[model samples]
Target: MNADIKNKIIKYSKEIGIDKIGFASADPFVTMKERLRVQQENGFQSGFEKGTLEERTKPDLLLPQAKTVISIALAYPSKMKNAPRSVKGDRRGIFCRASWGEDYHHVLRRKLNLLEEFITNMYPEERCRSMVDTGELSDRAAAERAGIGWSGKNCAVITPEFGSYVYLGEMITTLSMEEDTPIEDQCGTCNKCVDACPTGALVQGGQLDATKCIAFLTQTKTMLPERYRKKLGNRLYGCDTCQTVCPENKGIDEHRHPEMEPDPEIVKPSLEPLLTISNKEFKNKYGKISGSWRGKKPIQRNALIALAVFKEETSLPSIIKVMNEDPRPVMRGTAVWALKEIAPTAETKHLLQSFKTKEEAPEVLEEVEKALADLSSQGGMYV
Candidate 1:
């Protein structure tokens, strides 16, 4: 019965547009528990993790009488058609590939809900609980255990079919099922991802220091640390440096799902106009995409840094406006830093010095003083 039901579920998953599906016993994730403990102790967690260690690793804790776990993967396009260029005077900032489409949480949840409905219809007395990324159970761990993919050294699940560009979701079920074999690690001795990491966030092959990671850094609502500012490049949301450099992902660009296709302008938007984008405008434009989860502040702040990275002289006025008029202290402080990088001119120094008198926020005032000192040391070149 378990085998027959597993086969039926797999077929139904394919019919529902699931790219890959695998089944596993609802056993506690022993190895993952230890690794997560170490990660917590070392402060390597990104602070976005949802649940306690026990709940995260044990399926039964989440679903009482759980006997099987089902993992599903969906492939998203890696390449954009008609991707817009980021030229000087019209510089742009990027959201990573994972954030290119409608939020995967919504997309995956819909599929999981369908699967749950199918299961309950087949077994009236059985129960199920489904979760995407936000769930207590680790999606990657469940995926790995279910033979959906191997856990790559880059901390991504790398499938032979989809590389590492697949989105994962899982269901814990009361119905017993035969488990699939877990995939063996295929990242042997390849350190390309670690070597190419912008901020050395991939401490070694498999370990990541989330605090130093540009992807995590970009999502923070507070002021970006000076050390990682330049490292951010033009990325406004998540960073895909490690994934891009992986040999496994080199020539793989899936276009299986239309909803996952990127709108080039939305994912890679002009940096200048973002500085003053109203809240309503921002939501209407970017509300559906996963990158907008933190709202427009982080994206706008990253845009400021990105403009500075490019030394976009054309965006100087906008940056100055943000420094002077933006109500958010973080935005004002970031704009001051952007001014220091983009135009450390006599005019900029004068502007900073004058603003310093009226800036009440300690953080923004500190940025103003730093900009003034840096400009003074540079002899304040005229723009």
Candidate 2:
């Protein structure tokens, strides 16, 4: 009966657009519990993680009588075709592959919901609980246990077919099923992902320092530390450097779902107009994408940093406008730094001096002072 049910579910999953599906015993994630404790101790947790370790690792805690975990993966496109160029004057910032297209959370949740309905229709007495990225359970751990993929050195579940460019979701069910064999780690002796990390966020083979990770740092709402600003490059949201450099990911680009297809202009948006985008305009443009979860503040701040990276002289006016008028002090401070870096001049100093008296926020004022000092050292007037 278990084998028959598992076979039926796998067939239904493909019909419902699930790229890969696997089943595993719904036992506590013993190894993962230790890893999570160590991650918390070492301050490597991304803080975006959901639930306590116990609740996350114990399937029965999430759903009583849980006997099997069904893991699902949907491959996403890694490369953007006909992507708009980031040229001079009209520089652009990128949203990472995970944020390209409609949010994966929505996409995966829909798949999970369909799978849950299928299971319930077959076994009416079997209880089931489903969750996507924001769920209490660790999706990667479940995926690994279900033989969906091996956990890569970059900390992503790397499927043989889909590589690492996949969104994961899971369902805990009361029905028991024959479990598949776990995939062996195929990332032997390769250190490309670690070496490729701009921030050295990958502490070792499978561990990551969330504080230093460019991906986590980009999503932060507060002012970014000076040390990580330059490392950001032209990224407006998330960081795919580690995945991009992985050997397993070589030539692995999937475009299965139409909703998952990226709009080149939206994913790589112009930096200047982002500085002045009204809240409603930002929502209208980016609300559907996963990158917009933190709202527009962080994206706009990163845009300023990206503009500075390109030394976009034409965007100086937009930078100055944001610095002088934007209500968010973080945005204003970022603009101040970008203005000096992109087009430092006598006028830049004059603008900094004028804003100094009016800037009441201590953090913004500190940024203003730092930019002033940086400008002065570079031959701009100190006063």
User: How displaced is residue 172 in candidate 2, in Å?
Assistant: 0.7
Tens-digit per-residue lDDT, 88-189, candidate 2: 978999999999999999999999988899889988998999998899999999999999999988999999998999999999999989998899998999
User: Weakest 10 consecutive residues, lDDT, candidate 2?
Assistant: 374-383
1-383 in candidate 1: lDDT tens per residue? 87889999999999999999999999999988998898899999999999899999999999999999999999988898998899998898999999998999999999999999999999989999999998999998999999999988788999999899999999999999999999999998999998889898888767788988888999999988888899999999998988999899989999887888899999999989999999999999999999999999999999999999999998988888998899999999999999889876777777887888898999888888777777777662542
What TM-score would every model get versus the actual structure? 0.98, 0.98
For candidate 1, what's the RMSD?
1.2
Residue 188 of model 1 has an lDDT of 89
Cα lDDT for residue 354, model 2? 93
What's each prediction's clash count?
Answer: 0, 0
Could you tell me which residue pairs clash in candidate 1?
A: none
